[model samples]
Structures are given as C-alpha cells and as structure tokens.
Target: MDLTPRTAPEAAAPSTRRRWVPLLVLGLVVAAGGVLVARFLTSAVDYYCNVDEIGERAGCEKGRSLRVQGTVEDGTIERTDGTTSFVISFN
Candidate 1:
C-alpha cells in the first residue's frame, strides 16, 4: 500500500477554511450584540432638562420629568406636614 501523505495544496485548503469560520461567526455575534445594546439603552429612558436652552426653546410646565438648573430663591424653603419644598428662580 502507498503511504505517501497528501500534497501541500490539499493539506492547506482545509486548515485555511477552519481558521476563518470561527472568526466570521465571532464578528457577526459582536455586531448583533452591539445593535441590541444600543436599542435597549436608547429606549430605556429619555432625559430632558428644564434649564435655559430647553426652557427658552420650549416652555416650562408642571408635571414634567425634567432637570432644572437655577438659583434657589431666598427664604423659600418651607416644611409643611413633614414635606419640604423649595422655590427656585432661574435667569
């Protein structure tokens, strides 16, 4: 029986294909994960500030979840029924 091994081209073909398969699969997985994370983070919550730019562009209204930046009004801190409230004045 002839015991000579296969030629170099035959041996190299399978090795090259095996090496690239895992790399391609890993790249696809990472891309999918990135898209999922981006969608989740953006949809989780929306933040809006009631400061100068936002307040001027839009208007300030009550019962809106907002971030307000202003100077605390003097003598406006009051405690009523164990609940504290303060008034702020913005320029």
Candidate 2:
C-alpha cells in the first residue's frame, strides 16, 4: 500500500453513537425496573379500615383484601379443624 505520515496514532475521541448507546440502554432499563417496582408495591399495599366503615370508606371496597379493625363479639368465634372464624363489630 501507500505510506502516509501518521499525525495522530489512535488518539481520536470515541464516536457519539458508541458512547450514547450504552447510556440510553441503561436509562431504559432503569425506567422499566422503576415501573415494575412501583406496580408491585402498589399491588402489595392493602386497604385498612374499620369494620363498620367497610361500605362507606374508599379503601374498603368489596372483593378486596382489607385490614378491618373491630371488637370481637363473644360466642362468634368458631374453631374448626383447620380454620378459626370469628365475627367483629365496630360499635
């Protein structure tokens, strides 16, 4: 081949595409992870409310798991072989 004088020996800056590609990929991964974590945390969170306020409160919607606070009434506790069920009252 032809001989040319080398002014700069591999001392050039890296191209913009090579540098920004990884950074862009990392940013997208982080955003996706954040969205997944947020959805998981929100789904794991349960609604807490009083027994009497089940239908009146926004967090006490039916068919949803809830942490209801109430006083246990006597004679309502039933202990079966594998389960113990009871009734509670707020008033």
Candidate 3:
C-alpha cells in the first residue's frame, strides 16, 4: 500500500506571478522618479556671473541666459513688448 500523502494538482495552486506584479510596478515607478530628478538637477543650474565674464566664463557664453551681477549701464535697460534689452558694466 502507498504511504505517501496525496498532493494537490498544479492547476489548484496560485500563479507565481501574482506575488511579483506589485514589486515590478514599484520598481518601474522608482526608476522613473530617478530619471526626473536627474534631469531637473542638470537643467536647473542658474549661473550667477559678472558682466565682464560674458565671453570669459563658460556658463556666461553668448546667447545663454544666466544671472549677471553688475551695474546696468545708464539708459541701457529698455523694455518693449515682451522683450527686455540691457547692457551692464563691471566697473
């Protein structure tokens, strides 16, 4: 006579994937968050520079927008429509 206990069939057991679905989704969310933070850090640098460093500083290159620390020349700050033009002196 067989003494081994009978076992349930494979179809009766729960799928292994049921336990990993939530973990997989959590991992994806974490990865996406990391990417967003990295992008923000790289693009959010507002370089503070002097007017004399326009061409001498890497962050103050031509056509690049950054914070310039200097005196705005007399009558050089002009505001027309949506644009503002200005010139600064380091002296």
Candidate 4:
C-alpha cells in the first residue's frame, strides 16, 4: 500500500468553483454600486445662504435648493398643524 495522498482532490471541487463564481459576481456588483453612489453624491450641487447674504444676493432663480441661517425674529413665529415657520432677522 502507498502512503502518498492523491493530491488532496485538487484543493477544491467543481461544485465549490461554481459557488465562488456567484460570490465573486456579488462582490463586483457591490463595489460598482458603491462607486456609483459616491460619484452621484459628490456631483450633486450644494448651496449655502447666510442671513446677511440672503437680501444682498438677489436674482436667485426659483426652484433652487438652498441652506439659510439666521435668527428667528421676535413675535413673528407662526405654527399650524404641527409645523412651524418663522421670520428670520439678521443685524
């Protein structure tokens, strides 16, 4: 009787190779999705508006998204239906 092992069945079976194919495909898909999401988020436009800049910078076209910062004016807050809107004042 020989004591040599028969190459340990080639380190992996054919069924295992097929299984790894799907795993490799899934990993590639996830990597591509992440890259696409990152690119989309980075390419998106961002606008910033300060309290003083709002009045000074006019001609802002309608339907443009913006971020505004200011202090709420006294006696100018109005609330309705669980939502609140305020008039901001900047010195």
Report the number of the highest-lDDT candidate. Answer: 2
Worst 10 residues of 4 by lDDT: 54-63
Question: Candidate 3: how many backbone clashes?
Answer: 0
lDDT of 3 by residue, 46-66 (tens): 888888888897888887668
List, residue by residue over 5-90, the lDDT tens digit for candidate 1: 86765433457778999999999999999999999987664445545545454534554455677777899999999999997776
Per-residue lDDT value at 32 in model 1: 100
Candidate number with greatest TM-score? 2
Clashing pairs in 2: none
Q: Write the per-residue lDDT of candidate 4 for residues 36-85, one digit (tens) a residue.
A: 99999876755677767754675333456667767899998999999998
Superposed Cα RMSD, model 2:
5.4
Candidate 2 segments whose C-alpha is farther than 4 A from its true place: 1-10, 79-84
Clash totals, every prediction: 0, 0, 0, 0
- lDDT of every predicted structure (CA atoms): 0.73, 0.91, 0.87, 0.76
Cα error, candidate 4, residue 21 (Å): 3.4
- The reply for model 1, stretches above 4 Å from the true place, is 1-9, 15-24, 36-65, 79-84
lDDT score, candidate 4: 0.76
51 in model 1: Cα distance from truth in Å?
Answer: 4.9
Q: Rank the candidates by lDDT, best first.
A: 2, 3, 4, 1
Which residue pairs in model 4 clash with each other? none
2 versus 3: better lDDT goes to:
2
